[model samples]
Target: MSQLISIPESYESLNLTHINIAHHPPQSPTATPIVILRLNRPDKNNAFTPQMGESLEQAYRLFHLDARVKVIVLTGAGRMFCAGSDLDIGFDDRVERAGDFRDTGGRVALAMHRCSKPTIAALQGSAVGVGMTMTLPAAIRICHEKSKYGFVFTRRGLTIESCASFFLPRLIGMSKAMALITTGGVYPGLSKYFGELFTEVLAEGTAVLPRALEIAREMAENVSPLASYMSRALMWQGPTSPEGAHLLESKVFHHMAGQSDYKEGVNSFLEKRKANFLCDPYEMSPGDYPWWSEVDIRVGPKASKSKL
Candidate 1:
C-alpha cells in the first residue's frame, strides 16, 4: 500500500500513483535518504504488464527527479522477483497509433538507464526474460543464492527487448552473451557464467532486500550525492572513446570543485564527521550532466525517414 506522498518542488512534475514506494528512514542518527521501489504484482510473481511498464517508467522518473532520494532499491514483492512479461494483456492495439510499440520493457529500461541515483536490484527469486534484462541498468545487483536468471527470448520465440543487446555484451563480454542467449537457459547466481553479474548472493530470499538496503545506506550516508550522480552519469554514458571519457571526467571534476559541497566535503573529513550533502543534483550538476547524445540510450531503433 503506497500512499500518495508529497514531493519536493524539483520532483513535482511526475506522478507517483502506480508503484509501491517505501521510504526507509536513516538507520544511524544522520544517514542519507533511502527509498525502495517494489514491483507489486506478487500473485503472478510480479510479471510485468504494459501498465506495469508505464508505472515503472514513471516511478523511475520520479525517483531520479526527487532530490531527497539518495539511493534506490528496486525489487519485487513476496517470494519472487519478476517473472518477466505478462502475455494475458492486449498490448498490440496501441502499436498502430504508437508505431513499433512492441518493446514496452525498453521504456522502463531506458528510464532506469537515465537515472543518476545509485541503484540496487534485489532479486529474491528467479528473474526471467525482461526480468533479467531490465536490471542491467542498475549499478548493483543482489540475488539470493537460490535465485535463477534466464534470457529466454529465443526459447519463447520473441526477440530480445529492453536493450539487452547493448548492455549484456558489455557486462559479460560478447562471447558469453552469445553463448547464453543461444542456449536460452536459466542459471543460478552461483553458476560460473552468470556469477559475475551479481554483487553478492545471500543465503535466502529474505536476506536479499535487507542486505541491499544496508549497502544503499552505507553509500547514502557517507558519499557525496552530487559526485555520485555525476560520476554515475559518466559511467553509463559510454562515450565514443577513452579520450571522450577523460574529457567528461575532467569537466565533471572541474564543475564539482566549484560547488559549495566540495568545501563541506573536505571540511567534514578534517572535522571527523559525516558530510551533510545539501547540493541536490538538480541544483549542483554541471551544465551538461547528460552529456551523452540522445541517440545513445533512447528506447527503440532510429526512425526511418519517409521518402516524400
Candidate 2:
C-alpha cells in the first residue's frame, strides 16, 4: 500500500512561486539537512515553463552555496511528473539573435550538475522530453513501476536539450542512449531499453516519492555529506588510467585524512557509535580538488571562461 506523505511539523517551507522548497530537518541534531524541491504546477501535469526552469536553477544554486543542505529530492506535484515543455507558452521570444540564445532547460541541468549535494529524483508518473532530461544529473532516481518515460524531442521535430546527450550515454551506455533518442518513444519505467536508469521502482505511484524520502532520510542520517559529494565527483570525472587513478585517490585520501570527518569516522568506528562528521568539503577542499576542466554551458565558447 502507498503510505501517506505528511510533512512533519518541524519542516519549513520556502514557498517559492513556481516550485516548493521544503526544508526537512534531520532526526538527530547532529545530522545534515535534507531539502525537497517539488514541481508545483499540478494543474498542467507540472509542465515545464520558463519560470519553473528559473526556479529550479535558483534552488540548485542555493543548495550548492548552503552548507546546511546535504541531500535534495526532486519530485512533481500531481499524477504526472511533467508532460515536457509548456508548448502553448512556447519558447522564450525574448532573444534577438539565435547565436546568443541559451536553453533554459540546459541552464537548469547545468545548475544541478554544478551543485555538489546528492540529489534523488522521485518520478511519480510519466516524464517526457525536458522533464526526463532534467533528472539525468541526479545521483539516484526512484520511479513508479507504471510510470512511463520518453525522450520525445525527435517526435516533436525538436533536438534534445538539458545536456541529455552527455549524461544519458554515460549513465545507461551509448547504445541504449542512442535507442532512446532515435525512437523518441515513451516506455515504461521497467522497459528493457531503460536498463538500470531507475535505482528503485515501486508498484504504486504514491509509494514512489515516499520511498525516495525514506532513502534520502537514511542518507542524511548515516552518510557523510562531504564524502558522498566527493565520491560522486570522483566517479564522474576520474582519470582513465590505473596509475593516474591511484595517484589521484592517494592525494585525495591524504588530504581528507587530515580533516575532522576522518578522525570522527575512525573514533566512531572504534567506539561503536554513529559518526558525527561536521566537515564542509567545499570549504576545505584540496588545492586541486576539481582536477578536470569545466565547461560553461551558459555562454558561447568564444566568450566562455574555464570554471576550474
Candidate 3:
C-alpha cells in the first residue's frame, strides 16, 4: 500500500481546488503512484466553464511538475463524463474576451495536447460538444461498453470546436469523423467496428473508473516515464515522411540509448529483478524537450512563363 499524496489547498484556477485528487496503489511493488483527476461537478454533469478551462491548463502544469504523478486518469464525479459546456450560464466572456474568435473548448484541448504526462479519459457517462472533443487528445480514452457520446456541434448550430478537426480524424478516420461531426447524434459505444476510438471498454459506467486505474497502474509499474513521454511526443510531433520519422527516432535513440535509465534497465534484466528507473523524464529529454523548433518557410523565385 502506498501512502496517499496530499495536494496543497491552493490550486484556485478552473475550480481545481475542489477537484478530487486521489492516489491509487500500484498493482505491484515496483509501480509508481497513479493520480486520479476527477471532475467535481456532479450537479451540472461536470459541464465545462471557462473556469474549468483555466483549471485544466493549470492542472496539467501541476501534473507535469510533480514527480510523484506518473499518470493521470480523468473522469467525472457523476453518472456522465461531462455534459458539454454549461448552457445555463449565458455569458460570452470566453468569446468576447478572445475578440469573438477563440473557443474555450479549443483552449482546453490545446492544454491536454501540451501536457507531457500520459493522459487517460475515463468516460463513465454522456459527453457531448466540449465534453467529447476535450477527450480527443488523451493518450487513451476508455468508457463502458454502452457509454453515451455525441458530436453535437451541428445540432447546436455551432461548428465543431476544441480542435477536433486535427485529432478526431486522426483517431477515428476521416470518413467516420466527417459523419459524426455532420450528423451530431448521441450514440452508444462498444461496437467491434470502432476499436481504435476506445482503448478499452468496461461492462458498465460504474466499472470505467476502476478499469482506468488498473490500466494507469499497469503503465506506472512497468513503463519507463522518460521513454513513454518521448515516444508520445515523437508520435504526435515527428515529421510526415518515413525518413523524417527515422531521423527523429535516431535522434531520440542517441539521446536515450546511453542514459542511466538504459543502463539500469539492462542490469535489471540481467539480474532478473524489477528495474528502478530513477531518471527524471524532463532531464532525459533532449534540448528544449520536444526539440521541434519552427523554421521560416522560404519561397522559391517565381519563374516567368515565356510564350512558347
Candidate 4:
C-alpha cells in the first residue's frame, strides 16, 4: 500500500484589521465548501471606498490561498449590492497607484476569471457601475426578479471598468451592449434574455444568499474536485479543437492523478462514501471559456418607464 500524505485542515490565522477589511466567515464544515463575502458597509448602502477595494483584494487573495474554500458567493450587506464608487472620494486620483483605471474592471475581472474555483454573484437589489462590472466575471449570477442592473458610466462621465468592453457585448450582444454603455441605461429584464449575465432570476424580495449557498453546496457535494477544476479551466479557455483541448487535459490529468486526493476520491466512490478532499478546487488553475462573436443585434420593445 502507498503511504498517504496528509494536508493541513485549517488556514493560518492572520490579523486583518491592519488592512481594514471585515467579513463574516463560514458557519459549517462540508466536503464541498462555500465562502460568502458580503460588502460590510451597509450604512452607506455598501458603497465601495478605495480602502475597501484594497481590503477586497486582500480577502480574495486569502481565499485564493486557502485550500478549504471551494466556491465563493458574493453579495451586499443591505439594500444595495453596490451603489458604485463613493462620490465623496475620487477613485480616479488613486487610479495610477491602483493599476489600470481604464482597465480597472478588467484587472479585478481577471482575478475572478483566473480563480480555479467557481464564483456566483447573488444580486438582490441594485448593482450599478463597478458593482455590475464585477459580476461579469462570475461563473453564475442569480438576481431577484425585481433586481435592477445599470451601466451608469456615461452618466457619471466615466468609462466602463474591467474588460467590460470585451465581456458585456459577448453576454448581451453588441447592439444591446452599445446602447447600454453609451446611454448609461438601466434594465430590469436584460439578464433574463441574456443568459450570459444571469442564469436564474428569482421572485421579488427573494433572499439571494440562501440560494447561492445551496448551489455552492450542491456543486461541492457532487462534482469531482479534480475534474471540476480541469473542466472550469477548459471552459475559461473557451472553445478549442479537441486536439488542442486534449493536450491541456493531458497535463491536468497527470497532475491530478499524482495528488493524494485523486486516490481518495476513487477509493471513496468505490466504498460508497464521501471523498475527503482537503484542498478546495477553486484554488486550481482557471479554465478557458468562449468570448462573444460580433453579430447583427436588435433591441427589444422599450419599456414605458425609461431605465436611466
Best TM-score among the predictions, by candidate number = 2
| Candidate 3 local lDDT, 212-291, one digit each (tens) | 88888788776778888888888878889999999889988888887888888888889998877776785668876667
Q: How many Å off is the CA of 258 in candidate 2?
A: 1.2
lDDT of 2 by residue, 168-189 (tens): 9999999999999999999999
Candidate 2 stretches greater than 4 Å from native = 1-15, 25-32, 298-308
The reply for model 1, stretches above 4 Å from the true place, is: 1-18, 26-32, 90-93, 97-99, 296-308
- Candidates sorted by TM-score, best first: 2, 1, 3, 4
**22-130, model 1: which lDDT tens digit per residue?**
6676332322278778888888888888888887887777677677788989999887799888778734446444554547788888888877677899998889998
State each model's CA lDDT, in order: 0.79, 0.84, 0.76, 0.66
Task: Indicate whether candidate 3 or candidate 4 has the larger lDDT.
Answer: 3
Compute each candidate's TM-score over C-alphas: 0.85, 0.88, 0.84, 0.73
Report the lDDT tens digits of candidate 4 across residue range 1-308: 95543333432232332122222244333322566667667777777666666656565665655566677788887787888777886664643233323343454676676666677888877878888887887878888777678889899998887668877887778877887788887777345334457777778635677788788777776666556656665665544788877776776677677767778888899999877776456443334322235332232343577668
Clashes in predicted model 3? 1
Indicate which candidate wins on lDDT.
2
RMSD of 3: 9.2
Candidate 4 TM-score versus the reference: 0.73
